[model samples]
Target: MDTENCTNLYLQVCQTFLTCKYDDPTTFDDLYKLLPWLRQSLTCCVCANVIVDPMSSTQSHCQHFVCGKCKGGKMILRPQCSWCKDAEVFETNQHLVVLVMCFKKICQLIASSPIYEHILNYDQQRKKELAAMKSDSPAKSDTPSKRKRPQRKFARTYVTSSLLNIPVQQVLQDAMNLKDVDINTQPPTVECKT
Candidate 1:
């Protein structure tokens, strides 16, 4: 198979196998049977780890990389054009293209599922399409919209105890050693007049 088709095929197969999994490890070992080069080609594109799924008679190439569609990256198809984000053309001469296969059919399902038109470098077009999809009636939704939860909100911060209640400008000015005039006192200090 040509590189483009090979990659997309593997991805599609992976997507399919993964999505329809039952609570068993029936075909898990078959995931290791893909071509070695195909295995190395798509490992990094994914951002996180996921459980490897089993494939029946079909071959699976990648098993660990979490599906972008199901995870935080959103649903992007395998064999994404080097130049285009979701281009499905099957040209192999493109030097920038990377062929990949999926052990689970998640990628295939996502790729086939209807989605907003993908555009390259067209921020306005992409934004408009995204907005339209987001607002489209829930009745039109064939896929779920579960966004990954935001990371922990209580990480380390620079707002120290000394400046906890202090104004922002004062804190910034103090950091920069920028002096400010105090308006609360007369001169320095004054005894209360009886």
Candidate 2:
């Protein structure tokens, strides 16, 4: 693969490895056994692409790096980021870019390893499962199950109580009196025994 493609693949594998790390700890542990420091670095949060040249609009709020293509596509729709939704006033993250560049060779080597292929297969299988679930759900809804709606033993009837019937005028009078009453003008009610 070309350098750019290799970088992209490395990023994809890294992302999948990290996702497996958090989401499926067992699988992550298995992968971790094969490659320990797989989840130690960052990748583009948007497209799972390698952030060779890291770009971020806001450092304080949205610190995640986005690749150029993803950022450009987002810019077309709106000037806000896909992950952070911050304005598209991005600055080049020189430090992160340099670090990623330095690690490119190592990433390329990892990309060629069997662990990377396993992660890639895992990602594809997960995607297939998701799609199957989505398709199956719509089919399930279309062919509704023959579930009988339960009949109520006693019909629900709402009854108003006449026990504590106060006139609306009395309620309004009380509310108006409350508005007129001032705590500052009221005298204290307590009587001293002495």
Candidate 3:
């Protein structure tokens, strides 16, 4: 598939995987927690979401990066830096953009793999159980204060493996190393952080 189409599909699958409520919270928690650092490092300061078309303030001291949405929507840098109070212009941060793209690919791979399919199956089963419980207590259905069942936590490795019913590490390693990706061509200046 084309790059944009592939990205959108991966994002959709990731969204579906995240929304499912697992019976054991750690079934995916340990493995999934590794993905968010990509966003935290390169996201817009204004919207606080993953940066799309990343641009940074031109001021020397505070070159805070902001996403295109924040730049065009609110005019965050009309007169001064919204973050550092300096009058500055926006400049394209190609390095940050490259970094974001690379990490996004890694995340997409993990999200679009067998683990996602496993979650889908588990969510279906969980939904059926919830439906049966609701039917059994019809009077409590309309109550906003209905009690929720407490989910017990299990060992991360054990839970993750049991959920997938497979060798988790081998599958994850295979997913991460799916294709020949050469991100080493990034410019040396890419190391600079916002």
lDDT of each: 0.30, 0.42, 0.50
Query: lDDT per residue, candidate 2, 1-194, as tens digits?
Result: 12343345445545645556333446543343322222223344444434534666554644555664566433211233355565355555555554455445444544555445555555566568867988887443566568968663322110011101222222222222221222233323456798
lDDT of 1 by residue, 1-194 (tens): 23354466466445534553333333322322222223333322332122111111112332223232323232232433233233222112221122221222233332333310111122354357768988994775668668957663222121122223232222222223312223232322346888
Better of 2 and 3 by TM-score: 3
Candidate that scores best on lDDT: 3
Better-scoring candidate (lDDT), 1 or 2: 2
Each candidate: RMSD: 27.6, 28.8, 14.4
- Of the candidates numbered 2 and 3, which has the greater lDDT value? 3
> Clashing pairs in model 3?
none
lDDT-sorted candidate list, best first = 3, 2, 1
For every model shown, what is its TM-score relative to the native structure?
Answer: 0.20, 0.34, 0.39
Q: Looking at model 1, which ten-residue stretch has the lowest summed lDDT?
A: 49-58
